[model samples]
Target: MDVAIIGHSLLGGPDPAPAAPRADAVHNRRKILDAAARIVADEGPEALTMNAVARASGVGVGTVYRRFGDVAQLFAALLDERERQFQTAFMAGPPPLGPGAPPGERLRAFLHAMVDRVVEQRELLLAGESASPVGHYDHDAHLARHTHVTMLVRLLRPSADAALTAHLLLAPTAAGLITHLTLGRGRSPQQLKDGLDTLLDGVLSG
Candidate 1:
């Protein structure tokens, strides 16, 4: 048997390579992402720009491009953390909104929670949609939401067209639609929640 020894231990491989200098890259990346998030949250999505992020993160503008590419890519990464947190809440958080409650009740809570989520990230979501409207329906997060809703619809009524019903249920939650209903028409988030409640009644009752 031939043993190949590259660095140190016979099979243990070489001495640990120099600690990756990427720690600085990672730190800078976090700074940029956090800065982008704060800009969106504090000043609105319109405020997010490569230059603004560079200034806020104290990194050079070129570094922003190096770390996250262009504006569209930055927007996508910005949504990553938020989408993860929102999904965690309804996917595994607690009862009526999560796993422990009856399917009907859980679905209702999920829809309402979704309304609140849209309100929370309205500008960010709208901006992301504007940047990539065609891809929105095909987004992994969107598909995951659809899958979850379909499961609930099926659980509530085995004979229902669960797939179609899931799509319909999610229609009202689109950031653009929600924005139109609220900012364009002077409707409120509470009203959106009420509408979703009514919608759930019609869908699940039939």
Candidate 2:
């Protein structure tokens, strides 16, 4: 046993950190994702096939399949990339939305930022919800938003039901609700933002 341990140490312990992706692999992945985003943005989710992505990206269809596995997973990758950027912004970017703002102002900024998020990704978000109705509440993005809001609410209202308050605050930003209001009821994004501000005013004042 001691000899084995000594041999392992000589071989460089525990396998060096997993090697970074090959340069070509990284380049191909970016192209495929950019292509997928364009297809979804231009023609919506239904048009996003492996073949379509391949053509748009100028990569082979086999490469697309190997990289993303399937259309659903590929679409998910797109959402994941955009979600990371949004999370970074509110978690660490500037004041008002990121750090350093009072809980009230930070909460307000988050709700307003959510309005922009929905507007920018309306089609994708609606499609995701339609595909997995119950999963929305448990989604990584939703959980992040909920946790952020819950913390802010706790800070602003020490005696309030922060967890429940976070849920209530986020309810209006639901994709289905936003879609119904903006598309089904002719309400604009700005109107939605204003409504959020008004809602926050009441919540924070209480």
Candidate 3:
């Protein structure tokens, strides 16, 4: 048996190798992403030009492009990172659950905590509208909401078709809907909590 070891350069093709990022380049990329988030939250989605992100991050325009290709790529990356953070907080970070609470109570706490994040990050949440091409909803946030809904089902386990219950919960608990109700229409936090309680009661009353 002849085993040919493909060299690193030969493994892909003769195409231009992606240059390894320098320490400064890596730092610049982080800065650009952070700055983009800050600016988009403070201003609006329309404010997230590559030039503006570079200026805000103190990186050259070329650096921004090199790190993120273009505005769409940059926005996608930023939203992805934010989505991961939200997931981490709910699943692993110090929160209403703290990783050891009973499943039923954890489900309730997760709902409350999720609403709090939506309210606290209202502007950032709004900027996430571009998460979809139609600019109508944040796909990442939707995915997260589905994740939350699934967790609720796993925790609640009321024998009413867990998957369907997850879907029902997801529709109303999605980030966009929550934002529209709480931040946009001035729904009180307690009111939102009560709604969740009612939702859970209906689901688990069996």
Candidate 4:
């Protein structure tokens, strides 16, 4: 399965709401998001605008504004959906990633998976981090990942400062840094994962 599709399915399968959204509203929203995702994927987030989205989605500019407020909010919603999918994968989807593995192994798997996700969505994520540097730390997705990593770190080294250690471990995987390493330095995702494993070796072995 496509990673995004698998993640999306793991997050919730299909909507099970008893009261489904209005057909037209749902259609319009899907169109807008599809257009927006394509635009960001093709031209980068900086190229996104309500007018551009409206034209691409075949919706009126007023409709785009009514739905998303602005470019930032649209990107926020997009990121939120993607983040939820990622969280679901690591939180409840499978062994090593979700559960049923040793703390060290799961932590390794998590880091590798995160590297894949960041590389796949580098543009959107870089834009998000650029939009708010400190705010990234406060995002629900980041907090959740931090909490999971903290738990793993605590299991691996009970005496260590798990919270701080978690933050330290995650710092290297920050979107901007990943973007720089991949785009500027031409590092592959596997290389990033290998570096993460080297860091884990020191933390886990000591």
Candidate 5:
């Protein structure tokens, strides 16, 4: 897929600003998100409740509800911010993971980076995936990664089914799979990256 098309489709049109949000509103929103993130990090996704977040943030429950409809939406907002950062890193931040490297190298680097991300945020990501197995594929985070992988795959193998291949490549990196490998099998991130490199060797050389 064309990078521009992917950006447009995944990002959608920007919403109009509400005549500059109030400074207090902005401060409160950041406080809420930060507190919720800390709760999830220190405890777990199950610990992330509206009341818990309000208490942690020292904000009113009504304020928390007004900003984020529920715990799920709060998680989504956190994930959105994270995904945007990842997208920026891979799309434009640096070489190998970004625009400067050869496509084949970039593809390998991308998978390695993904392994790191999934391992680091395994619990939250698993929660997101568990919320909807199939619907998760439709998320902007997944689409952005898919778009990037498809582009690299096409460059590496012009005749390959880039979209399908991209999906296949990403399947192994799913949060559930990573959790199973890391927690269930006691595999390290380096082990996962090595395995991805082995897979890439065959796919790219084919």
Candidate 6:
């Protein structure tokens, strides 16, 4: 591992203290991902080509490729970042869970929190449709989904198929679905939130 990371430094001494990531490299990477996200949002996932991302980010094509390897890799990296953000928001963010509020309210707040994140990450998700054949990017998403469903199931009545019902409840409110319903068909966020409340009410009425 040391050899892989530091090459000759491993022979010299303990990998030479690991240089910090260059500021320009970090900035360019962020810029590329941001540009890719914006392009996806503006023109759809199909627009997220490496060349286009490089142009949009004002970085060279080589720079984009070096940062991301390819369009699929870039999308995967972006989704991975989104997954981390979502995890932090739902599990560790302000209020409810962070403040020791009631379980039910925490659950509701979690749902809303998930909704907000899904909405924000819609573009990355769309771009990720054709992401790497390996599917590592999806690992975090799958984990989050199961973790969320498990939490919801614990709060739900025993009669409900917790996992199935969780999926049903969340599917419509998922980023892809919500985007289609809202942007594609002109539905408002309030309308969707109301429907979400109704769904949750039915599920939790017990």
Which candidate ranks first by lDDT, i.e. highest?
5
Q: TM-scores of the models, in the given order?
A: 0.81, 0.89, 0.75, 0.85, 0.90, 0.74
Estimate, for each residue in 83-169, the C-alpha lDDT of model 1 and write its tens digit.
Answer: 766667777778887778998998888888888888888888888778779777777667667877888999888998999999999
Q: Which ten residues in a row are the worst by lDDT in model 3?
A: 1-10
What are the per-residue Cα lDDT tens digits for candidate 5 across 1-206?
A: 33453244332444344688899999999999889878887898999999999999999999999988988788888887777778878987788898889999999999999999988777778888999899879866788789889989989898999999999999989999999999999999999999999889877899
Clashing pairs in 2: none
Order of candidate numbers by TM-score, starting with the best:
5, 2, 4, 1, 3, 6
* Backbone clashes, each candidate: 0, 0, 0, 0, 0, 0
How accurate locally, in lDDT, is each candidate?
0.81, 0.84, 0.67, 0.84, 0.85, 0.66
| Pick by TM-score: 1 or 6, better one | 1
Which runs in model 4 stand beyond 4 Å of their true positions? 1-20
Sliding window of 10 residues with minimal summed lDDT for model 2:
1-10
Model 3 C-alpha lDDT versus the unseen true structure: 0.67
What digit string (tens of lDDT, one per residue) describes model 3 on residues 126-189?
Answer: 5555344343333444544555566667656755576667767655655678878876799987
Task: Give Cα distance to truth, residue 167, candidate 6, Å.
Answer: 2.2
lDDT of 4 by residue, 29-147 (tens): 88998889889989999889999999999999998899889887888778877887787788777978977889999999999998998988888888888888997787666777888
* lDDT per residue as tens, model 2, 1-206: 11122112111243255689999999999999999888888998899999999999999999999988999889888887787778778888798998888889999999999888888888888888898898678776677778889889999999999999999999999888998999899999999999988889987888
Ranking by lDDT: 5, 4, 2, 1, 3, 6
